[model samples]
Target chain A: MGKTYALTGNPNSGKTTIFNELTGATQYVGNWSGVTVEKKEGTIKNSDIQVVDLPGIYSMSSNSLDEVIALNYITKDKPDGIINVVSASNLQRNLYLTLQLLEMKVPVTLILNMMDEVKRRKINIDHLKLAQILSLRIIPTGADDRKELKNIKDTLTLDEVSNFNRFSYFSEDVQKAINELAQKLRETEHRLENDIHWLALKILEHDREIIERIKIINLGAVELGYKLRDEIQKQTKMELPEILAKQRYDYLREISEQVIEDLDKSLVTETVTDKIDKVLTHRILAIPLFLTIMLMVYYVTITGLGDKTIAFMEWLVGDVITKTVIAGLNTVGASEMVVSLVVDGIIGGVGAVVVFVPQIMILFFFIAILEDSGYMARIAFVMDKIFKKFGLSGKSVIPMLVGSGCSVPGIMATRTLENERDRKLTIILTPFISCGAKLPVYLLFAAAFFPSNSHIIVFSLYLLGILVAILSGVILSKLRYRGEDSDFILELPPYRIPRLKNVAIRMWDKAKDFLSKAGTVIFAASVILWFAQSFDFSFSRVVEPSDSMLASFGKLIAPVFSPLGFGDWITSVAFITGFAAKEIVISTLSVLHGVSEGALVTSLQNIYSPLSAYSFMAFILLASPCFAAISVMKRELNSWRETGFAVLYQTSVAYLISMLIYQVGSLII
Target chain B: MTIVDLKPGQSGQILELNLSTKIKNKLLELGLTPGASVMFVRTAPLGDPINIKVRGFNLGIRREIAQGITLK
Candidate 1:
């Protein structure tokens, strides 16, 4: 028979790493707790056992979202067994969760991750003694070491998971109180899946979730439980929860005294972590250093190294692939119409967005390094101060940065944030940052209107995006999402040489997502645009694109954007098509005007001056995101109502800002 | 005095937490208890969240949280 087990651990304890190593399921393991905000399941490799990996939690308490989610899964789902992953160096705190798990009567096997790090620190742990003291089986293992990983796999058997022993850690009077409470609860004609002792303890601690549960089953139990806790609280100088915590720690300290041998720290004066933090997180130097780094990342990932590769891709696909396809089709005696559909609709349209894949992948590569190397969290810490002034937190920074690459993954990255309101606000504002696909639109306008200052014009557009995002964040917080994620906390994991395998896997995953999107969405959009411009209504060929079906449709919506200064049917059509995918906007323009890609620049110059052109660029920067990003936003946000609000709000903001820029600039000039 | 009274590199035992139940519970869950020694490691660049070292590991928490935590 197949068995099912769950993996639970504190954040940054390498729980997901063990899950990947053991199950061969490559889930994205971020440096912090956000990526795996939801539970994921995969079958253990070469075994019948199924392993469910839940989000990391510091405790089973339901105050925070992660805790509530993880706690609910364990209580409601009741997996047959649990593998408790703990950072060996931080065993005291990690084990606190283990004790909670044990009280719930789930069979647990402790996997001591980061054992290698402990060894490097020269600290020694007697695992056998610790295991015996806690009445839980402990397996000392490291995430990277083959031998240690093997030890974990060897213990994944049915018998091993069910091998833990039961022990009590509460003080005498507290234990007596818990016993009486459990006895009283058992007397009630109600059934509960959890061990009665755990329920009694949680109730005594006034866990709101469990108290609500008690109110349903036996309302009297709530009063009784609180009465017992009040007596316990009155006797202790410490608070009610701390009374329990003290007892647990007292027992834990005794266990650690026997199990952990202190190492001579004088041998290694100050850790490299300290030396690095002194500089990287320095009070005065941090923000300047961070700005310099962000500029470097922008230059290297988007323009310097990234642009060279993008240029190569554009050349290879546009010149070489088009030439080869035309030659092959000509030999096969393909019709001119068919050839036009194949070359212009398919290759020209999709290839525009496809060339951006390299740039997106480069951004992902850099983000992966920062994430895997542990700098992402530090950046959050450094930026949290400034961000809070805007009613957001530092955690919103990653999603915004990732938004520049692509908004789909950018919305997905908001899972790293723990607060509901903050996540929603970030999702609403992330798409405003100019993505790689929108780069084509900006480049086109800048080149046509302001050739000499195109670079500066584009740079200022990027800044405007950031400015608007922050301002919108402030307004949203003050109006709708009120408080910050005041439980603003993050564990500063020791920095290591980021494992290359993890970074590569993350990059490959992002690349595949980008490529798949480019293949399907852009391909379909291109064919539709081509057909719209090539044929008139009733499916007849039109010599002039102005007489085609798309032109009529563009004329209808053209007036809506008239106030923004670029209101012609052609511009309207381009705007409408750009919604399908931003990169296709330029391609749509080239097709509508019946000009070569190179000559489309001068043709666009004939349409609009620099003033209106800048307004159009501003609109594109803040408008509703593409369909792919919209779907991701829906998934990440709480409700359809929120998603609709986000979409409508973005488009409205875009329209107002564009109109403001155009009207103001027209008056000034 | 509150934890903010401690300078960087200063270590003290936690005395009390004058905070909301949720935030205080979270702090206790993260293993900060009365009498547990914690070092005020350093302030971040923007000087909002203060980093602390406890149980041989580091954590960054908001300064408002730090101000509510009494230590000696």
Candidate 2:
């Protein structure tokens, strides 16, 4: 059997960069068995040594989702070895995770990354001495060097029978308690296959996951465990976690004193990071700088270059593909029904959603740069104060920003939020942001009704989307998700130049995901929509769509929207087709009205006044996201019931707000 | 004094964490132990969640979490 090695490290330790380099084209990404934490695993290039890239974690304490995923994979899967990545610049704190990996009895090869930064800061680390002290192979590597990359691959294949006997960092009293409990645990069904001492320490530290697991597997062990825990805390005058962490740091401090020069002195005395942060995260300049950056991002993605790319994609998919396919079908003597199905149902429906790819890509491109350069963390740092007021964390800003371009990737980005409630809340709130597709709907209505102040009306609709999201966040935090601690403790990683390759790779992944969804959910929706619009009650193809089954269905649902004032069958059909894609709302109306997009404004002018038009725009802004977004919601929420709840919440909120806008305006105006 | 009690640029040694066991375990793991010195870097723009330097790294810790950590 090929040897399996688990790649583990502290977050922001360049673990991902190392994994990408080592695996190259051999890696594939998938969701972990139960959770949304992404699992990346692959064979080392040119070798059969399998590497499972466990989620980046500070410590294997199972205190966080990442920690639990790493701990479970290591303990249950029982990988042969661990490739623990530690940044050299922050050696002591990074080594904290390294020590935890050692205690698991897995032989760990330490990759001391960012050696150049250490050298630049004039902080000297005796890698040879450090390796000897810990009894692990340490490869100190700089970012620019490829020499150590090969060194890492070579060490992974080696049989590491490491004697990490220095792993015993606990005091005598704590060690005695652990030894007693570990011995007792061996006899119970709580017999961990390996590292029972580590398990003992965890239970003593009040690791709820392990302790709860022990309670079911070995009930009698709980009594002894609690008794020992109480004794240790009383004897040591320290909580178990405190004791464990303190002892580990003490040992790390000791090792650093001997192996690292001037370990007590601050290694970073106003480094480049601090210098940049002074302006970027300054007391007065920070928020303004952040706002300017966000504006630039929005301008580039939504209104500027991003808009041109999107228009190009629309032209490519709409006119080019549609015309080419029609000519091909005509030459083949295909029937009119087949031509309509392929052109209108297939190209028009799926193409409508696919056209947003450029905007999504451009948005993700900037997002990737922010993430890769580490500025994204500072964004959360700057925005946390305001976002916390609404029961959301600062990290929620990224999803909303991404949601403005498209909600699919926006919902996916919620995976970064570690708290379950925060992730769910962000997912529920994100679709309320006016995505680019919804913008066309707003502009069309705005132009048709309030021709002069269309820009302001469109802008108000955008603000309304944000206002509704914030209000919903407040409501949900109180009622749906209360008592769950929305804790925010984010590490501010040192900024680095964003790698173009990494940014491109991120865009590629998002693009691939979007295209796949367009092919599946949106593809199916269009075919069904075509059947609805094409056939009559007896399944006879009709010349006019108003005479077909869709009109009857739209007429039935039209009155349900009467309170919002756009209850006509034409508006109803547009919204129905909009379930597939929002941009299709304009096309559906244009098709049903027998006019092109330019004349669509004059056509809808009589149907809606300024107030009802604004109300109609309000409904589309906050209503249920398109079918493609719903599929993404299903995947991200990982449950149909929660996705259903999210859809219901969005649509109901949309209905109430639209009704309020229309009713209150009619009364006041 | 808790971490929130410290002004910007003020430094203190961690006395104890009064948070729940789970949160305390997390803070401890992040190197806010009894003896570790913490430097309150600055508060965020809207003045609630503060940035602090601990163990040679910066953490954007929520004000609520900071209020639970006793500093000396």
Candidate 3:
């Protein structure tokens, strides 16, 4: 039987590129159990070892679902041998989790990844010495280079190697506690081998899960823990865990001093990153830089390159693809019902989602650049103060920025936030940002209604989203959880020139997600929608009857939206279908209004006045997110009550905003 | 001086923590007991969670928590 090892690290730690090199074409990527976050697993080429790529996490402290999931899997499943991946350049911070894992007594092999980056920064490490001190097998692998990876694969047989010299600096009190805990363990029937001292120390520090485990073995362990903690405190006059941690850090510092040789010339890169930070992370300049970047992204994805691609795709689908299918159906003498189902239902519905793939790709392309270049972290860092005032962490800025591309990932990104209240608030407010999927819908309306000022209108819509998100966050914070604010601590990695290969792969991955949805869910949805629209449930002879099944159902709900100025059956149906996915709003409109290729703008103009169009855009912008987003919120928030509240709040806000826009705009016009 | 008074890049050993009950509990949970040597990392430009080295890891604590922490 082949053994499996997993490579895990924080985001931007070069994990993916390493995986790509190791596995190449032998990889299979799928979603983690019951979640949309991608799970990557692959067999190591020519080797018996299989590697699973878990999602990136900053810590395994159970602060977020990602952390919880990562920690639980490692502890419960217990991989054959865990590969602890860390950034070579950021060893000081990375060693924190490494120490935590060592304390867990997992057989860990440390891979100091991104050695090239460390070399570029002119930092030298004595790998053998450091490995001996850390009591683990250390491999310095440069992910960007494939030759180093091959070497790692060839040398994977070394196991049971323990370097005892790792503990260089243990406080006297901690050493005493460890001794006591080890003695207590020896008294039990079960052999407490393999770092029992470390486990006992963790228990004394009140690691919740460890405490629970110890309770199951012996309730008296808790008493022992209390005694040891008190003794340590009395002797050292310090908290047990803190004293232990300080000892570890001091050991790490001492080890780093002997192992790492920092060259003075490395100051150049630091200066460059700092100089860029002056403008990009500047208190006053940051917002403008962010806004400019966002605008460029939107412009490129919507009206610029993305719009051109979408236009071509629209023509291909509406003209060549659909028409060809119709012609083939006609020649085959296919039944009208079958023809309608295949052509109008399946083709139209799925085509709606398909058309937006280009835009999604472009949007993710920009996102990849921002993320890879390390600019996204700065965006979060700069926005932390502003978001904190609204009771959100700096981490909230990630979801908000991603929200502009797609609310699903944006909401999913909220898992980075440690506080439950703040996470929920960030999730609730994320939809206010105009996602890329909603861009076509916005373009359709703005071009129809506010043609000359479409740029300004588009810009204002985004601004409006930010304003609404902030206002809601503030109001909710005041009304709900008001206390000492949660602090935001983020590692600001030095900016580097983004790798084009990595950026392109990330963009392709995101675009692939959009295309896959179009083929599966959106295609099926369009077919179902077409069937509902074309066939009457009760055999009606007249196809255009007012009492037809689709018409009656649409009419039943149309009046609810009357005050918002788009109460027609077609508009109501578009809104309903939009709940499946935001991009469906445009496609539903295209189908219902009988607009073929190059006629979406004109058809939109015919269906709605400028005032109504603007109002409709506002409603969609504020409405309940798609099912995927809701599911993610449920998973991340871990409560249907919170998810239900989010839906209700978003829907209510959308209705009010749309009504206000329509009523006031109509009065003015 | 308190940790709040320490400049970036300064190093100190924790002497005392005078946090509010809630914050104190949170800190205790995070294992920030006194006598832990803390090295000041960079602060956020707006200065909320002054980055500090603890337990061989970098931790960001709010100014309110920093105010409570006495350092040498």
Candidate 4:
């Protein structure tokens, strides 16, 4: 059996980097908070020891969700040992969390990371003395270095374990008070006798949640906790929690002064981050620079190497594979209906969306680079000044940015928001940011309607999405979510060169997810839609598609959308199928019109004028997200009523916007 | 004066904390205790969230919360 250990640390302390190096797992590592909301486990390479990467936390106070998660895992799962990863670059703050872990009495090995950065600042740590003082084995290693991984593995292999002398951080009077409370706690029916010290400390601090838990153990524990809290407050002339925190800080400072040495000018040099931020976060240049970078990403994906790769896939799936499959079926005496179903319906429908995978991959690649290199935090920081004016928290920037890739995880990311109003407002406005699933719809229309200026048109669509989101956020915040704005506390991590391997892993993961969806949901939806389009109400095959069941159903809803200008049964059916998944909009059109890969624009031109086509694209861009995203929204919001409201609002807004654009464009054109 | 009053490239010692219990606890957890020397780094481009260096790390916080930190 493999021994299990939990790896824990402060946010951006290089915990995930060490986990990746030790386990060879390609987990996503970003340079900000809320990156790892869930605990992930992997087996160590060449050993049976399993390492669990707990979410980064500041302390074991259990105030936030991430801290609660880490604390609960330590107390409940009770891993065999803990690898306490601390940052050498910021030892004072990082050591506070390490001390808390030590107070839990869990066996811990300290891994001092970012030693390279520390050294560059002319700071030196006496690791031997520090380890002796803390009574733990300490190893200094850079996050990207592999040499110390073997040392960690070897340390985990040790069999003998002994309790170290517990350091008392509190004053003698406070210790006396804790001892009395601890003794009372032990005499009661409390099941936490083993953690009496921790319980007594929590009681003194009046940690509300901990007090409640202690009440279950023994009602007397609650009364005793209140008494201790009042007594501590009187004695210290400060809040109980603050008093305890200050004591720990004093202890940490004492150890830090003895064990760490820094040159006189360690804090005075113009660091690399300072030089870079002066320009990147400049007052006059930040917004325009951000826009230019985003424009370049879209331009390259649509017109550069991404386009070339997509063109090759188009030939392989649309022409070569389709032709060969139909010929083989004909030689084997397959019926014409079977050939049509296999070649035109199944292959043609799914192939049209599959060929665009290269472009999607390229887009995600750039997004991954931005996130990994720490620029995503800067974007949030820069946009917060604008987001605040609209009554949304700056934290909303994270969910919207993630929403660009997909809405499920994006909606889930709202867990980081402390205010309920901010979380809900963010959830409602998140889907307004054009997700990758909506890309195919925009590209299809851009190619058909705006050929030479496709890049700019698509870029404008993105800007329009942002505009709609801001307007809706403002309206909603005024009507329902009005209050004092939630505070934004963010960390701007030093930017690093994005690791190529990490970027490739992220891009591949996203592309593989898209391709897998194309094979499964898109394939099944295409076949079912083809059947519905091919059969009439009498259950007989129809010569004209207008006489089929799908057409009859589309005719029912087509008039409802006639005001938006694309009211044909075919386009209506495409919109209906699109609710299942966004990419199905393109596939449904190909199946309904019998158009192959390259002939879609010409076929669409017969049904829609360029002005109406743009309107249709606008509708698709703003409409309700796919069913999967809605289900996730329901789960995250935990309210069907709110989910229903979101979908209704989205579709209504899409309709109004599309109608306005089409009506005005028709007159002008 | 409060942290929000500090200009760019200035430093001060935190003298008092007068915020809600929740925000105060979070700041303490991040090593922003009273008497810690804090330097005002720079505001973001649009000048709402201000950066400060304390305990050898930079923290970016909005002006609303920064107003809670009284400094000398």
Give the TM-score of chain B in candidate 1. 0.94
Name the top lDDT candidate. Answer: 2
Q: Give the TM-score comparing model 1 with the true structure, all chains together.
A: 0.89
Assess the local accuracy of residue A99 in candidate 4 as a C-alpha lDDT between 0 and 100: 86
Computed on alpha carbons, the lDDT of every model, listed in order, comes to: 0.79, 0.81, 0.72, 0.80
lDDT of 2 at A305: 81
What is the alpha-carbon lDDT for the whole of candidate 1?
Answer: 0.79
* Residues A134-198 of candidate 3: C-alpha lDDT, one tens digit per residue: 77887788746656567665555564435453333676666667778767765663644335665
Model 3 chain A scores worst on lDDT over the 10 consecutive residues at A262-271
- For every candidate in turn, the CA RMSD to the true structure comes to 3.7, 3.1, 3.6, 3.3
Q: Which digits, one per residue and each the tens of the lDDT, describe model 1 over residues A486-509?
A: 347777777767766666766777
Better of 3 and 4 by TM-score: 4
Q: Chain B of model 3: TM-score?
A: 0.82
Model 2 iRMS: 1.5
- Best model number under DockQ: 2
Report the C-alpha lDDT of model 4 over A1-669, residue by residue, as the tens digit: 889898999877878677777777634332212333334677888888888888778888767666667776777778888998998877878999888777777788889998888777678888888888888888889745658767687887662232554438778867877778888888763467347776777777776657777787777877977887787688767887777787788788778888877422444455677778888888899889988887777778767776788789988998799889988998999998899888878897788778878877887788778877878778878888788888877778888877887776688778777666778888888888988778878877888888898887888888888999999988988987777566677777777677786677667867777888888888898888888888998889988888999999999999988999999999999998898888889889888887785798899888898788888988888999988788877866768998899899999999999999999988888
* lDDT accuracy of residue A379 in candidate 4: 83
Q: How many steric overlaps does candidate 2 have?
A: 0
Candidate 1 regions with alpha-carbon error over 4 angstroms: A1-3, A25-43, A159-167, A184-191, A208-223, A234-239, A263-269, A331-334, A415-421, A447-454, A482-487, A584-587, A590-603
- Kindly list the per-residue Cα lDDT of model 2 for residues A125-204, writing each as its tens digit: 89999999888898878778758777566787775857877447778888888788888788863455666777787778
DockQ of the two-chain complex in candidate 3: 0.26
